[model samples]
Structure formats: structure tokens, C-alpha cells
Target chain A: MVYYISFILIGIGIYGILTQKNLFKFLVSLTIIDTAINIFIISLGYIEGKDVPIYSKYTPVANFVDPLPQALVLTAIVIGVGTLALGASLLVRVYEKYETLEVEEIAVKEARK
Target chain B: MTIATIFVGILMIISAIYAIEAKKMLDSFISLSLLSLLSVFLFVIMKAPDVAITEASVGAGLTTAVLILALRRIGGDEE
Candidate 1:
């Protein structure tokens, strides 16, 4: 249930991005969708009633949740941030060149030119 | 227990819907921010604080700001 809901949220965001008219809205949707999937992927490693990952002195097999997902999510986040920055810069250039933000309008203007 | 997760789950769904159905780019950005925060909260409830931290910082914070800057530059339809 935990993982499924996260996936559904991600799907919703992706649908929005695909069907949207505004480039800015699509970009925002893409970022949210991206994060949601990362969260979902990380959450998959968690088991109910498990403790943090530590094997130093005490506890047994039931104690630790999988640590790999946490690590992966961290890496995904760094990449997400970099992609968002790059995407935003591209959007800025698109806006400057087109002088309008609506995707349809921009396309029409390009077609005319 | 499952209750907290369920609650966060509902919030996530609502935020996702709002993010999609938003009428304007700014509205979409705000809703997307809300959705990201809800996902972060869900991650925390799932016992993944590391992911929660990054989502809070990158997803909810920096990403939203960047998209908003993009919005300002693009100046969407204004309708």
C-alpha cells in the first residue's frame, strides 16, 4: 500500500506533464513526478517495524531495513536537482527566444517563422 | 501504524490531483510543491529519512524555485 500510493502519485504527475499546455507547468510536473518515483523506490526497502541499519553491537536479522534504497534515492536526488537546473535554464532560453510561454503559441509562432 | 501512512497517502493523492488540474502555471507549481512535500512526508513515515531530507530540499525547495523562475522568464499566457 505504501509503495503503490507513491507510484500512483508519480503516474498522476506524469500524466499532467504529458497533457499540459504550458511548458512551465510541464516542467514543474516533471520534477514532482520524478521525486515521487524516487521516494517510492526508496520506500520499497523499508519493512514495517524494522530499525535503522546498524549491526555494531546488538539486534538481529529483523532489525535493519534495506540501506541500499536510501543510498540510491540520495543519488537520484542529486541528479534530479541537476536536471531541474538544466531544464529551467533551457526553459529560460525558450521563453526569451519565443517571447511567450504557452506551448501551443510557441509552436504556432515557430511554424509561422 | 498504517493510519499515519494512510493519512499521508490521502494527502498525496489530493496533491497529485491538484497538481494536474491546476489552471495556471503558478497554480500548477504550487500544487506540485505540495505534492512533493506530501511524498517527503510519506518517505518519512516509511522510515526513510534520508530520502525525506533530499525531497524536502531538492524537490520541494530548489526545484519549485527553479520552475518558478522559469515561469517568470516564460511569462505563460497570463490567462
Candidate 2:
């Protein structure tokens, strides 16, 4: 159920990326895509009734949910933030150079040059 | 748990759609942030506290701030 939703989110993001004219809109779509992927990975580790993978005196490893995906997603969240920041900064430079965030305009300017 | 997951999943998809289809860039950004928050709830329902915390802080918190700052610098509208 959630898996299919993740796929739908990815499709929406892709549609936005392909159709949007603004660079910042494109970046937002990219982040949405990244988020869908993250959700899919985290969902892959879910086990019904399993306790979180916190090691404690009463917690048994047998019933603990998978810890690996959580760790991976932790790293992924930070990486996603870094990627967003980088993309935003690059958009800033593009705006400075082209004086517009619209890709069609930039392409037109390039063609005239 | 399944019901909770489904609810959050639906919320996430709805917000993602809004994020992509909204007219204003700031509105789209806010929708994206809402999407992240829904995902955080989904993470918690999935029994991944670590991921939930990370997504809340980075996705809903810092990413929105960074995007907002960028929008402020460039101005939010495409025109």
C-alpha cells in the first residue's frame, strides 16, 4: 500500500521535474523524488509488532525491527539536505548569470549568444 | 498500524501533488515541508524512530529554512 504510494510520489516528482519551468521548482521536485526513495527504503524494514531496534535490558533482538535501514535513512536525510543546499546555491548562480530562473528563457538567451 | 501507514501515505501523496502543482513557489515549498512532516509520522509508525527524528530535523526543519532563504535571495516567483 505504502509502497505504491511511494511510487506515485516519485511519478509526481518526475512529472514536476519534466514540466516545471522554474529552476527552484525543479529543485523542489528533485527533493520530493529523494523523499519518496527514502520512504520506500524505510518502509522496507517495517515488521508488524516489532519493537524499535533500541537495545535495552527488556528488549529482545529477535523482535526488534531492522536497524540497518534506519541508519541508512539517517545518513540519507543529511545527504538530502546537503544536496538541496547545493542545488539551491547552483540555482542562485544560474539566476545571477541568466537573470532569470525560467529554463526556456535561459535557453533562448544561450541561442541568441 | 496498517491503517496508520495508509493514512500517512495518502497524506504524503496529496502534499506531494500540491508541492508540484501549486502556482506559487512558496506555496509549493510549504507543501513540500508538509510532505516531509507526513513522512515523519509514517517513519514513526514504521517503528523507525531514528529516521523519524532525522527527517523531522533535516527535512521539515533545515531544508525548509534553506529553501526559504534561497527563495528570499532569488525572490519566490518565477517572473
Candidate 3:
């Protein structure tokens, strides 16, 4: 289920990137798509009847739920934050220089210059 | 219950479709948030509370923040 849904999201993101003409809109769609996959990755490692991998007397190490996925998701969340900020700043710059948000218009303007 | 899972699965599918097919960027963004939340429900039913929490927080909250920030940068919608 995770694999299938994740792939569907990737396809949607690809479609957005391929078809979207608004630069910021494209970025929003892309982020949605990226998030879907990240959730999928976390879902993959889920194990029932096990405790969180936190070190404590309640949870025995032998019965710990997979900790790796949590760690990876943490990293992904940070990276996503950074990428989103950078994308937004670049988008602002793009809008300022081109004076329009349309990707085609921006490309045309750049080419003419 | 399997029936509920199947029903939730249907909702998940619908949300996924909405996320992809929405014409407005904001609509699509909202749909995406809905889908992730539904997936968290799915995770809970599948017996993964930690995943549900993470998905609800990072997947829905943080991701929504990123999308909204990106949208603000884009400004008003176009035809």
C-alpha cells in the first residue's frame, strides 16, 4: 500500500512539473508530492507489538520498533524546510527580475536577454 | 475492521485524486494535506502510532507551512 501510494504521488509531482506554468504553483505541487513519499518511507518500517526505540526500562532493545525510519524522516523534514525556504527566496528573486510569475514568460524574457 | 480499512482506503484514493486533479494550487495543496492526514489514520489503523504522529506533524504541519510559504511567494492565482 505504501509503495503504491508513494508512486502515485511521484507521478502526480512529475505531471505538475511537466505541465505547470506558474513557478510557485509548481513548487507547491512538488512539495506535496515529496511529502507523500516521505510518509510512505516512514510507514514502511512500522512494526506492531513493539515499543519505541527510546532507551528506557519499559522498552527492551530486543523488541524495539525500527528507529532508522524516524531518524531518516527527521533528516528529511530538515532538508524539506531548507529547500522550501530556498525555493521561496529564489521565486521572489525570479518574480522581481522577470516581473511575472509565468514560467513561459520568464523563459522568454531570459532568452531575449 | 477490514470494511473500515477498505472504506478509508477509498477515501485515501479520493484524496489522492483530489490532490492531483485540483486546478487551483491552493486547492491542490489542501487536498495534499487531507491525503496525508488520511494516511496517518491509515497508519493508526495499521497499528503504527509513532508513524501517525510523525505524519500528522511533519507531513501535515511542516509540509503545509512550506507549501503556504511557497504560495505567498507566487502571489495571486492566474487563469
- Give the winner by lDDT: 2
Of the candidates numbered 1 and 3, which has the greater DockQ value?
1
The local distance difference test score of each candidate is: 0.77, 0.87, 0.70
Off by over 4 Å in 3: A48-62, B1-10, B43-51
Clash total of candidate 3: 0
Candidate 1 Cα misplacement greater than 4 A, ranges? A54-62, B75-77
Put down candidate 1 lDDT per residue, B47-72, tens digits, no spaces.
77777788788777887787777677
Question: Which 10 successive residues of model 1 chain B have the least lDDT summed?
Answer: B70-79
lDDT per residue (tens digit) for residues A18-93 in model 3: 8777776676667767666766776677676676566667764567667787677756766776787788788878
**Per-residue lDDT of B2 in model 1:** 81
What ranking of all candidate models by TM-score puts the best one first? Answer: 2, 1, 3
Give the best candidate by DockQ: 2
Question: Model 3 reproduces what portion of true contacts?
Answer: 0.14
Residues A7-96 of candidate 2: C-alpha lDDT, one tens digit per residue = 999999999999988888899899999999998998899887889898878884568888888898899889889988999999888988
lDDT of 3 by residue, B1-79 (tens): 5567566666766776666666776787687778778777766654456656867787688777777776676575545
Taking all chains together, the TM-score of candidate 2 against the true structure is 0.94
